[model samples]
Target: MSNQKIYQYLMAFGHFCSDINQTALTALLPFLIAIHHYDYTTAAMLVLVANMVSSVVQPLFGHLADKFNWVWIVPVGLLLAGGGIAATGYTSDFWQLCLAVMISGIGIAMFHPQAAKLVNLASGLHNRGTALSIFAFGGSTGAAMGPILITASIALFGVQGTLTFLLIELLACLMIGRYYRALTELNGGSIKAKQANAQATQQDQWGAFSVLCVVMFGRSIIYYGLNTFLALYWINVLGTTETVGNTMLSIYYTIGAICTLFGGKLADKFGARNVLKCGFAVLFPSIALLAMTGNELFASALLLPMGAAIHIVYSPTVVLGQQYLPNRIGFASGITLGLAISIGGITAPILGKIADIYGLTTALYSVALVPLVGAFLLAKPKD
Candidate 1:
C-alpha cells in the first residue's frame, strides 16, 4: 500500500506494543509472585516501579516531540522494552525481576508520546476524533488481550515460556517500525508546525482543561484498581477459579474497548462534559455490584458496564484535553495518555496495601467512593 498508510499502521502498532507490555506486566505480577515465591508487597512494588518510569519519562518525551523531531525513539524504546520483558523469564531473584521491570517501563516511556505525535500528524481535523478513537482502541485491545496471553503462556510453557511471547511482540514491533520508515521526518523541523497549530487554538480554554484533568484522575484510579486487583479478589474472596476470574477481568476490558468509541461519538454529538458525567454515574452502580455481589453470573453481567463506565470517560476526556491545549498537542497527549494514567499507576501500591490490610471487599468499596470525588471535581459547570 501507500507509504503514509504504512507509517500510520506502524505508529498504531507501536502504541499497541507499548500498551500490551503494560497490561502484560500487570497480569504477570501476581503469577510471578506465585511462581517465584515473591509476596504481594514485592509484586506491588514491581508494578509501581514500572509505572513510575513510564509516568516520569512520558512528559519529557511529550515536550521533546513538541520541540524536536524524535521519530526514532518509538522503535528503539520498543526494542529495549521487549528485551527487558523477555529477560524477566530468565531471572530467578527478586531484585533481578525488579530491574527487568524498570527497564521495560523506561522503554514504554519512550514509545508512547512519539507514536501519538505521529498519529496526530496522520489524522486531519475533521476525522481526528474518529481516528483517535481507533488509536485508543488499540491500547484497550492490548489491555484486553494481556490476561489471556499471559495465562495461555503460563499454561503451555510455564513462566519461562512467557519470555518467548514477549520476544515475538518485540520482533513484530521492529518489523513494523522498519516498514514505516518513510514517515520518519529526518530534520528537526516539526517544531514550527506544532507552534503554528498552537497559535491557532483559543487560549481561554484552560478552565476546560483543568476540569478534564480532575476527571482523568478519577477515572484512572478505578480503571487501574479494577484491572490489577479484580482477579485476585475474585479468586481470594469469591472462591472463583483463576481462569474464571481472569475471564471476568477480560470481559471488563472488552466492554471498555467498545465503549471508548461509543463515548467519543456521544461526546461529539452532545458534549464532553455530559458524556464524562455519565461515565462517572455508571461507576456508582458497577462498583457497588462488584463489591456487594457473590454470585458469579450476576457479577459477570455487571462487569459489562463496570468496564464500560470506567473507560467511557477515556475518549471524551482525551478529546477535551486536546481541545484545552490545542497549541501543545503532544504535551496534552502526554497528560491524558501518560501523566494522569501514571498518577493512577503510582496509587496501585497504596491500593494494594489497603486491600491487604482492610480486606479486598473493603478496599473495593473504598475505590467505589473515588467516582464521587471525581464527580465533585468535574461538577464545575461548563464554561
Candidate 2:
C-alpha cells in the first residue's frame, strides 16, 4: 500500500528468490548422487561450495552497501541467482555444476546485506524485529519450497526443469527494477535515521557480541547439519521415497519459517537473551529425539520443536548483533546474518564426512551436543 511497505516486500521477495537456489542445491543432492554415482562427501561438497562462497563474500558486499547505496543489486542479484539454478540441470560436469551453484551463491551474497540494509532503512524503530522476521520469513519459505520445486521440476522434465522457477525470479526483478528510483529516495531518509540510531547505541559491548557469535556458530552446526543430510537420512536410512524424503525436509523449513517469524516478536517481548536461552533448551532434546527416532511420526514430532528452537534465535541474533555494534551496523549484519549463517554451510562438508564415516544419525546427534555450548554462552543483555 505505502512506498516503504512495497520496498520492504520487494527486498523480502528478493531474499526469497536468492535463497531458493541455495537450498535447492541441497535438495538436489540425492538426485545428483544417484545419477553421477557420487559419494556422500562429493554431494555435500556442492553445498559446501555454494555456501562457502556466499558466506565468505557476503561481508564484502555488506561493506559496499554501507559505503554506497546499492539498490540495483536486488534485481541483478535475483537474476544471477535464478540463472544459476536454471543452468544447473544443463551441466553434466561436476566442476561446471559447482561453478553454477557458486554463481547462485554469489547472487545470494549480493542480495542479503543490501536487502537487509534496505529493510532496516524502510522499517524504522517501532517494527524492527517484525521487519527482520518478515524478511527472514521469506527466505525460510523459499528454503521450504526448494525441495518441492526441485522434485517436481526433475520429475516433470528431468533436471533441466529447474527452468520452471526462472519466470518467477524474472517477475520479481521487474517489479523491483521498476521502483529503484523510489527505493533510492526512501534510503535518503533512512540513512539519516540510521545514523541517529547508531549514535544512540554507541555503548559497544564487544565481549557479549563475541559470545553471541559463538551462540550462532553452535546453532549453525545443528541447523545446517540437519539440512545437509536430512533428505539422505530419510532415503538411505529410513528407506523412504524421494518425495517422502523431501517432504520431511520441507516440513522442517516450513515450520522453521513460522517459528522465525514469531520468534522475533517473542524476542522483542522476552528479551533476545531469554528467547535464545529457551531455544537452546529445546534444541538439545528435540534434535536428539529427532535423530534417535526411526518412526516417521516421532521424527516429525521432534522436528517441529527442533526447527522452532533453531530458528527462534534467528531474528533475535541479528537484532542483537546490530545492537552490540551499533556504530558498525553493516559489519554487524554481515557477521550476524551472513557470516554466522555461512559458518553452518562451511561445515556441511565436514558433517557429510562424518555421516560418511559414522552414519547420518551419529553426525546429526553430534549436532544435538552443540546447543549445550550455546546455552552456556547466554548471559544478561547489555541494555
Candidate 3:
C-alpha cells in the first residue's frame, strides 16, 4: 500500500484537474460573449447549466460513494470535466455550448464528495481540518490556472485553443486510474485510519447542517458573483478591456489559491468555527467596501480581501459540516462542497437579469450584501 501522503497528494492532483476544467468555462465566457455576441443572461445561463446540474446530482454521487466502492469517480470525472471544455472550442451554437458545459458540471459533481470522504478518513480527527484544507488547495490552484490557460490558448489560437489543455487532464486521469487502489487504501490501510473511521459517531445533526447550508449558500453567492461578474465589472463599470479584465480575474484566482492553504492551517489552529466567524466578519465589510470603489486599480486590489474572506471558510465549513453530521460524511461534503456552491451558481442568472435591467453597479452592490445575510448563522459553535 502507498503511504497516506501519496494518496492525499494524488487526490489533490485530481481536484486540480477537475477544477481547472470547471473554471476554464468561467474564464472562457468573455470570449464566448465577444465572439458569439451572447447577452449577460445567456452567458450566465451557461454557468447555471454547468453548475446547477452538478449541484442537483452531487448528493446522489455522494450517497453512492458512501454505500459502495465508487472510486472510479476520480479519474472519470477529470476526463468529463476537461472533455467538456475541450469540446467547448469546437461548437458555436448556444444550445450545444450549454450541453458541453453541463457535461463538465456533471464531471465536477462526480468528484468532490467522494474525494472529500477519502480525505476525512485519511487524516484522522486531530488533523482532519488541515487535511481537507490541503485537499481544497488543489481545487483552488486549478481555479487559479483555468483563466490563464484558457485565455492564453485563445490569445494564440482563437476559441479552439482550449483543446490544447485536454492533454493535461488526460495525463492526470490515467495516472489516477492506474493507482486506483491507492485511493481505496486511504480508508483502510492503517490501523489508525480504521480507528479514525470507526470513531466517527453516527449521530446526525440535520438541523445544524441545514443552517450551515444556508450560510454556505450565501458564501457561494459572493464567490459566484466574483467569478461570473468581476470581468464584466472591469469592462462595463471600470472601462477596462477584456484582456485587462481577465488579467485581474487571474490575479483574483491566484491570490484565492494561496489563501486556501493558510485558511486550512488557520482552521486547524484556531478551530473551524472561530476561523469561519472571523472570515465572515471580514467578508461582510470588505465586499461592501469593494462595491463603493471606482478606480480600476483599487477595484481590482479590493479583490484580495474579498478572496481571503471568502476562501477562509472553504475548508472550515466543510469540516464543520462533517462535525455536525459525523455519520454522514459524504452527505455533509455534498452539501458543503457541492450543493451550497451549486445554489450560488444557480443564482447567477438572477443576478445577470439584475445586471441586464438595473445596471452593473447595482448588481455588484447587491451581491456584496449576500455575506451579511449569513453572518448571524455562524454565531453558533461550528462543531
Candidate 4:
C-alpha cells in the first residue's frame, strides 16, 4: 500500500483500539460493584481516575511526540494498555482494580497524542479537515461498539471474558508496528526532525491560543456531559429501560461518526469555517428540541440529527486550531483533542451535581446553552 493508505489505516486502527475500551472499561466498573459486591463509589471513582489520568497525560506524550521519534511509543502503549485492562478480570480487590486501571490509563495517555499528531502531519491543508474527520469517525465507531461488545461478552462469559477482547487490540498494535515506516513517510517525515522546518513557533501566539483553548474547554464540558450522562438521563428521568437507553447512546455516537465523515469532506469542498458555522447553527435548535421533549421515540430520533450537528464541527475546529498555530500541529492537536477532553472530564462531576440537585432534564436544558456560547466564542477565531 501507499504511504497515505498505510497512514490512514494505522490511524484508524489506533483510534479504534483507544476508544473500544473506554465504554467497556466504565461499564465494567458498574458490573463489578453490582455483581461482585464492591463499593459503588469506589467503582465510580475508578472511572474518574482513569479518565482524568488518560486525558491529562496525553498532552505530555504529544510533547514527547513533537520532540522525539515517538513512533515506537504507540505499539508499546497499546500493549501495556491492553494487558492492564485484561488483567482487571483477575483482580479480586479494589486497590488491585484501581492499579490495573491506572496502568491502562497510562498506556492510553502515551498513545493518543502521538497518534493524533501523526494524523495531523499526514493531512495537508487542502484535505486536513477530511482526514481528521475520518480519524475521529473511526474512534467514534469504536466508542459506539464498546458498550455492545462488552455487554455481550459479559452476558455470555461474565466480565472475565474481557480478556479475550484484548486480542483484537493486540493484533492492531502489531499491525501498527509493522507499518511504522510507511506511517512515518505519510506523517511528513520524523515528527521531531521535520517540525523545525515549519514557520514561527506556536508559543508566539499565547494570547489568541489561550482564548481558543478556553473555547475548547467550554465545548468539552458540554460534549462530555452529553456523552457520559445521556444513558442515565434516559433511564432515570425519561423512564426508559437500560438496554434501550444504551442503544440511544450508541445511535448518538453512530450519527456523530457519520456526520464527522461527511463534515470533513464538506469542509474540504467548501471552507472549514462554513462547515463549522453550519454545524453550530444546526446544533442550537437540536438541543432546544431535545430539552423540550420527553417522548422516548422522539428523544431517540433527536439524537441522530443532534449528534450529527454537534460533532460535524469537531474536525473543522481542530483544523482551525492547527491553522492558528500552524507550526505546532502536534501541540495544537494535543490542546484541542487531549486537554479539551480532559477539561470536559473534570466538569462531569459538576454536571452530575447539578443533575442531582435540579433534575436530569434541567441539567440537559442548561447544557443546551453551553454550545451556543462556544459558537459565539469560536467566531473570534475567524476574525
Write down the RMSD of all candidates, one decimal each.
3.0, 1.9, 2.0, 3.2
Looking at candidate 4, what is the lDDT of residue 357?
Answer: 72
Per-residue accuracy of model 1 over 71-181 as CA lDDT, tens digit each: 777777887676677777887887888899888888877777777666666655545566666677777877787778777877898777667646756676667656544
- Candidate order (lDDT): 3, 2, 1, 4
Runs with alpha carbons beyond 4 Å of true place in candidate 3: 187-193, 200-202, 378-383
Candidate 3, after superposition: displacement of residue 108 in Å? 0.3
Clashes of each: 1, 0, 0, 0
Q: Which whole-number lDDT from 0 to 100 does residue 84 have in model 2? A: 82
Return the TM-score for candidate 1, rounded to 2 decimals: 0.90
What TM-score does prediction 4 earn? 0.87
Q: Which 10 successive residues of model 4 have the least lDDT summed?
A: 374-383
- Per-candidate TM-scores read 0.90, 0.94, 0.95, 0.87
For 1-383, candidate 2 gives per-residue lDDT tens digits of 97777877877787778777767888999889889999988988887888788888888987887777667877777887888888889989999998988888888788777788777777766577788888888888888888888998999999899887676689888888788887876655544575555556567778888998888888877778888888888888888988899899999999998898997787677777888888898888987887888888787777789778888788888878877866656667777877778778888888888888999989878878888886556556555
Q: Report the error of model 3 at residue 280, Å.
A: 1.4
Query: Candidate 2: global Cα-lDDT?
Result: 0.81
Error of 4 at 33 (Å): 5.7
Model 1 clashes, total count? 1
Model 4 C-alpha lDDT per residue in residues 1-383, reported as the tens digit of each score: 65664586578778778777765675464467567675433444566666688777777777777677667777877776776778778868778887887777777677766787787766664677778887878777877777677667777887787786578778987788787876665454654345445544434455666766776776676676676667776777689866666667777878887887887788778766677667766766777787788887788888987888777777776677777766666777777777766567666666666766787777787777776755444433322
What's the CA error at residue 274 for candidate 2, in Å? 1.5
Residue 290 shift from truth in candidate 1, angstroms: 0.6
What candidate 1 gets wrong by more than 4 Å, as runs, is 1-8, 186-201, 375-383
Q: Give the local distance difference test score of model 4.
A: 0.70
Residues 199-255 of candidate 3: C-alpha lDDT, one tens digit per residue: 464567787788888888898888888889888888888888888887888888888
Candidate 4 backbone collisions, by pair: none
User: Which of candidates 1 and 2 reaches a greater TM-score?
Assistant: 2
